[model samples]
Each structure stands twice: as C-alpha cells, then as structure tokens.
Target: MHPFARSLVTFAAATAAAIALHAGEAAARTPAKPTIAFVHGAFADASGFGEVTSRLQDRGYTVVSPANPLRGPASDAAYVASALQPVKGPIVLVAHSYGGAVATPAAKLVGNVKALVYLNALALDAGESNFGIIERFPNRFGEALRTRPFPLPDGTEGTDFFVDPARFREFFAADVPARAVARMASAQRAVSLSAVQEPAGEPTWKTIPSWYLIGRQDEVISPAAQRFMAKRAGSRTVEINSSHASYISQPDRVTELILRAAR
Candidate 1:
C-alpha cells in the first residue's frame, strides 16, 4: 500500500474512535430516568401525593413518596435525607405544604439532588419556623384547625392539629372531588404542633435551583406568603387557581411545574 493512503486510513480510524468516545460521554451525562423524592406536609402521608406520583411514573420517572413522619422539622428532614441514601441517580426533591420545610434541609444532605419543587409548600429560611411565618401571613385555615393532645412515644403529651372535617373541603381542597375529600378527612393524619413551631434547617433553595407552584386560592398558606417565599428564593413560580391541595385539584399544573424542574 502507498504510504500516503496508509496515513489517510489511520487518520480516518482515529477520528471515528474519538467521535464514538464523545458520544459515550454525552450519553453518560444524560440520565435515562432521574429519581424524584416527594415529601408530604403535615396532616398528610405519602398517599397525599398519589396522583402526582402516578403522573410522574407514566412519564418514565422513578418516584418515591416516603411517609414524612410529621415529626419536627429537623427530624423529618433527617428521615427524608436518610431515605435518599439508597437512591443512585440525580434527584428532584419535591415537597408539599409543611413538607417543603423537610425538603429544604434534606436536599442539603443529598449530594445528587439537582432541583427542588415546592407545591403550595413552605420554603422556610434558616431560623424561621412554620408557625412564625404563618403568624406573619395569617390564613383562614388557622381558624379551621382543631387541636387535641396525644401521648408521644416518650409518654409525654404533644398537640396534634386537624382541620374540621366539615370544613375540610373549604380549607384544603374545595376544588377536589367531594368523595376524595371526604376520604381524606376521614383518613387524615394529624400534624404535631411542634413540627410547625420548630425552627427549620438551612435553606437549600439558596444553592439549589427551585420551582414553586402557588395555590392562589389556598387558605392554608396564604397566597401572599407563597409569593413572598417564592420571590425571596428567586424560584420560577406558577400560580394555580385552586385550594391548598392544588396537587389534587390541579394535578396537571402541579405536574407541569415538577417536569420543568426535572428538565
């Protein structure tokens, strides 16, 4: 073979190999299925996110909606962060209501969390407590709650809060199905008062890119407060004309925001 022809063949092979290597690198950077970790707020469990979880699953995403414990903010955060220890890929940590307080610090503990989504959720800053912010931006839902004392694991007493069942639709999910709201009211988990008064952990939104979905008609967390927190965090925000349970009444809109964060 001619020396010139041999040189040309060698160069072509090298170029093809380099192109293959670059393609492999790009594929590695793109995750086929990113994990999404959902944290539910007070008076709710992982089941609170049932519809949203199903939607995400339909879109080829692995969703984990862990029971939030509804304990205190720090302990709840630690519980959620520990759940993520076994997950192997990038995570989009999504929170609802008080769950936002949990996700805020939990994200800091996980290195692979790529995005944060708050759905009518609390985005408390450092040194801030949920009740403190609620006091500052009072909502009608406060009037609807009925508190009762319950024995803790340590045998001490703790306060548990619940919205009046008759007023559940108005306070939490007026736009949701009546039957569903009825079931929710019957099965509602009580949120410990301590959880609301506890100071939140470090604000993860400071470092993580976040998206917020505000329930404009929310009586639980006033719309004004949601806007203030979202703006303060510099998050991409969208508003839905629904109750505090926007994810239930306006699932599409909520899912759209989550998809935006995942992308």
Candidate 2:
C-alpha cells in the first residue's frame, strides 16, 4: 500500500475509536435514573411525599425522602445531608413548604445535586425567614389560625401549626382522598415558631438551576407569596390550580415538574 494511503487509513481508525470512547463517556455521565431527594414542609413528615415519590419511581428514579427532624433548618439540613451522603449519581432535590428552607442549605452540603425543584415552597432571601415574609403581608389564613392556637406540650407557642381534618381537607388538600387527608391531619407536626423566625443564610436557588411549582389555590402560604418567592429565586415556574398541598391535590403536576428538573 502507498505510505500516504496507509497513514490516512490509520488516522481514520483512530478517529473512530475516539468517537466511540466519547460516546461511552457521555452515556456514563447521563445518569441511569437520577436520584430525587424530597424534603417535606412543616406539619408533615417524609411520608407527605408519597405520591410524588411513587410517580418518580414509576418513571425510573431512585427517590429518597429523608425523615427530617422538623427541629429547625440547621438540624433538618444536617438530617438531609446524612440521607444524601450515600447517593451515587446526579440528584434533583425537591423541596415543599418548609422543606425548601431545609433543602436550601442541604443542597450545598452535597456535591451530586444537579438542580432543585420547589413545590409551592418557601424561598428565603439573605437574612430572611418565612415569618418575615408573611408578616409583611398578613393574610386571612394566618389570622384565622392565630385566633385558635395549639399550645405544645413544652409550653412553646405553636401558631405555625396546621388545623384539624375538616379544615385540612377544605383548605389544604380538598382534592386528596378523605382517608389520606385524615392520615395527614393525624400525622401533622407542630413546627416551631422559631423555625419561621430564623433567617436563611444563603438561598441555594441563587446558584442552582431551579424549577418552581406554584399552587394557585394555596391558602396556607398565599399564592401571591409563592410567586414572589419564585421570582426572587429566578426559578422556572409552573403554576398549578391546587391548594398548598399541591403534591397531594395535584400530584401529577408535581411529579411532572420534578421529572423535568431531573432531566
């Protein structure tokens, strides 16, 4: 064979090999099924993300809803960090309500997180808390809840707590099944007044690619407030016509948003 022709053939073989290797690396980096870590808001446990989790899992995602202590953001973030420690691939951290406060700092602790999904979730600015935002705009729901408080066994004020079954269904999760709403009401946790009062240091949404699900019918946290937070976070927003518990009321939409972030 001519020397120049032989060299050309060798060059072509090398180029093909490089292309194949690059393709393999790209596939390896493309996460088989991105892991999704869900953080629930106040008055609920990890179980609150049941519907969301089921939907993600059905679509081939490894979902983790860490049992946050509900103590405060710092502790909750620590708890979530522990849950995130073992994850192997890319992650999409989904936060609902107070869960956003927890996941904000928690996402910083982990390296695998690719994006964040906020479901009508809180998005605090520097040195701001949930209480500060709400205080700026007093709403009927907060006023009504404040009228009838649930004093904790420790004697601390629990004004940020949830209401009973009938109210929970009507206001929070009217679209969810009665039995599920009852279970949620029964499992409701008394969020500390300090939790809302404490300021978030640095919100993660500022640096991360974030997607927000705004509940148009939210009463617990006003729909207006959700929009405000979403704007400040510079998040890609998707509005759902559901209550604050959109994960329960509009699970499919919530699931779709999460999967979008995972992509």
Please give the RMSD to the true structure for each candidate, in Å.
Answer: 3.6, 5.3
Q: After superposition, how far is residue 112 of candidate 1 from its true place, in Å?
A: 1.5
> Model 2 over residues 1-263: C-alpha lDDT tens digits?
99999999999999999999999999987758778999988777888778778888888788888876666787778889988999997889999888898899898888778899999788888888888878775566654242235566799655555565457777667677889888888887767666778888887788999999998878778888889989888999999788888987778888888878877
Q: Give residue 68's lDDT in candidate 2 (0 to 100).
A: 69
Q: Write down the lDDT of every candidate, Cα atoms only.
A: 0.90, 0.82
- Mind giving the per-residue lDDT tens digits that candidate 1 earns over 134-201? 89998678778999999988999999999889999888888989999999998888889999999876
**Worst 10 contiguous positions by lDDT, candidate 1:** 42-51
Report the error of model 1 at residue 8, Å: 22
Question: How many residue-pair clashes does candidate 1 contain?
Answer: 0
Off by over 4 Å in 1: 1-26
* C-alpha-based local distance difference test score of model 2: 0.82
For lDDT, the strongest prediction is 1
Q: Estimate each model's TM-score.
A: 0.89, 0.83
Error at 236, model 1, angstroms: 0.5
